[model samples]
Target: MVTPENVSSYIQQGLECEYIDVDGDGRHFEAVIVSKAFEGKGMLQQHQLVYRALGDRMEQIHALSMKTFTPEQWANQA
Candidate 1:
């Protein structure tokens, strides 16, 4: 029973993010994270960082879909 608030709070602690949107139906979530911390990290590392932030809650959370991007990547999309 991982709430959106729980995920939001956890992620905000590790990353200097511009935006974080989390949508969850209690057990599953879709997270869109935009942060400068993703700058030189690969997709696996980015996801790992997020997983670390969540701790054991990942097992409790059934599903997590993420769209992560660095600030520069985000800026390029605009």
Candidate 2:
């Protein structure tokens, strides 16, 4: 069974995230992912990057709602 941490770890593999918090059970998940890599990326590009990081795990995750932010963006949000 997949857990939040499993999803979190997947996203962390390819992205250099300042922070990552994932919530939910095996099928549904929500993530707050902060990374410097998202700085100049468009919404679609950012989402694609995250999706790529998840790779095959995307098949297992039924609902993945995410809030992606650059470090600068995150600082402003805080």
- All candidates' TM-scores? 0.85, 0.94
> Alpha-carbon error at 34 in model 1, in Å?
1.3
lDDT of each: 0.85, 0.91
Model 2 misplaced regions, further than 4 Å: none
Model 2: lDDT of residue 19: 97
**Candidate 2 least-lDDT 10 residues:** 69-78
Best by lDDT: 2
Cα lDDT of model 1 by residue, 7-56, tens digit: 88887886667989999998889999988778899999998888887787
How do the residues 10-61 of candidate 2 rate in per-residue lDDT, one tens digit apiece? 9999788899999988999999999888889987888899999989879989
| Best candidate according to TM-score | 2
